[model samples]
Target: MKQTPERILLPVSPVFIAVSLFVAFLLNLQPWGHWVGVPDFVALVLVFWGIHQPRRVGIGIAFCMGLLMDVNDATLLGENALAYTLLSYFAITLHRRVLWFPLKKQVWYILFLLLSSQLVQMLVQFIISQRTSSWFYLLDSCIGALLWPVVTAILLAPQRRSVNTDLDSSL
Candidate 1:
């Protein structure tokens, strides 16, 4: 028989969530080039928080973050906001169910979510620009999904519960 060590989760604070989002936003600022199809860390963070802390991080936060992303990218304003809001709605809607799955499986679902948001974004850009876009833009969704495990491990690290195994005798 195999023994799996049991662990508990510690309560998380809102500040931690805020700081992580801010850091993700900063990471999003890095210029990954228009051709690399680099993942959007901000989107990844928003989805993670949307799934894990919906009450604290809702569509409003996602919208605000998306707006910031819009300003940062210098693209059509509200493009990212719309897409991110849609993503937030989907993530929040399925958050409870998604929570039940293990991290590996969650990646597949998150990938779908990421792809949907990217599709929305691509549509918006297509409508505004009215030009055929290179398929590389969709690469961000795949990249984001690929990086989901790393993001999960980093975010959940702080919440891991440890059993000291030594009982305290203090009354």
Candidate 2:
């Protein structure tokens, strides 16, 4: 009989999560020039963590991150917080189903969640500014949705582990 190798899921450090959030914040702060349609990297990370580590990164954390985003971007105080909170809610609710599927399938879900977040932010902006946005404003969600697979793969790389052949024999 042939034995199949098992991979272990190592625990991610809290420091790693903090640093990832900070890096995403920096990414969100980049000057995209006319590319205001750039993906919301911070929101993407929030949604990802909400799905994969719901307990550790719940709505509170999402809201806090959103606040940071709002402050950094000089938008209304609760704008990003509301969007992130909503996104986190959806991500947590769908997490179980997401984990059961392959990453390819999860991409669709990620897109949906991201779009929803963008919608919330847009609504908040319209309410506050009392101005209608351009149809082109929706481009950010599309761009973000398209980036789901790449983002997921990058974030998941550290969690993926193959058995170390020499170390496996000692167990």
Candidate 3:
């Protein structure tokens, strides 16, 4: 039996991380964000970075991003901040375990994380508005989970090293 070699990933660039997060935030600001089944891009990206680069993208960044989301949405202050903070915390905590799983298996874990974040946001909204949102709101998390593999591929592209390296030359 032959074992497949694991591809070595280069160190992620801080600039790439920042750009990804910024793009996600912009996606969240789209008008379609309020539509059912529309995923929360910011939360998705946050979870991705939290799991893959916990040391660089942790709770503090999550909180700040959440606050920006709240301001943009004009929702009660701290609603998204609290949810995102918890999401990042949990993702960071489970980073090692998650990395051990294959991409397909990782979907289940990502689903749980995304669902929990949505639940927190829903609960906060309920508290502020005294109204219950339709159950379909959770669909966003499901969509986000389904997109996990694609997101991982896109986000990790910058860090993926070429399979063939020239030993004779140092770049």
Candidate 4:
């Protein structure tokens, strides 16, 4: 009797992509702070996916995802795209280090990544729209940073279980 291992799909499959996009749309559409803001849920999901499945999701997808967000939010074209692309690229570069770190450490790194992405987006908005930056610009990053742990916990739970199982089998 041949016992084959169950085929587990990559966590970041098309379904995840669609759900992420939908969440992004909701963030853009949701009436939050008098329609002035909402958390960048898509960015959060993308960061998780990037760290978890860097081999499948890459810079191009990140850029396109940002562009879609821009179009949906009616922001200057390429602003979100640039931010997302840069974030994704950096995440990919640091993926190995992030994976090795403990959850708390990874949350800190992801917070930085989220802030960096927002900084890039803010810079673009300032340059293109010549809009005055407000303190409120930092709010999304703060919320995202706070949510980082929760998001990471949810995303990594299954993987951790699988990894533990593998370790047990090897031992």
Best by lDDT: 3
lDDT of 2: 0.81
C-alpha lDDT (0 to 100) for residue 163 of candidate 3: 73
Cα lDDT over the full model 3: 0.94
Q: lDDT of candidate 1?
A: 0.87
Which segments of model 4 are wrong by more than 4 Å? 1-14, 33-37, 157-171
Q: Per-residue lDDT for 26-130 in model 4, tens only?
A: 766565622324568878877877887787778888888888888877888888899999889888888899977666678778878988998888788888778
lDDT of 1 by residue, 1-171 (tens): 555644677877888999999999888887653445788888899999999888889999999999999999998999999989999999999999998877778988899999999888888887988865677878888988989999988998898875564567443
* Predicted candidate 3 versus true structure: per-residue lDDT over 84-112, tens digit per residue: 99999999999999999888899999999
- The lDDT values for all models are 0.87, 0.81, 0.94, 0.75
**Each candidate's TM vs. the true structure?**
0.90, 0.86, 0.94, 0.77
**Per-residue lDDT for 61-121 in model 2, tens only?**
8889998888888888888899999999999999999877666678788878988887887
Pairwise TM-score winner, candidates 1 and 3: 3
The clash numbers for all candidates, in the given order, read 0, 0, 0, 0
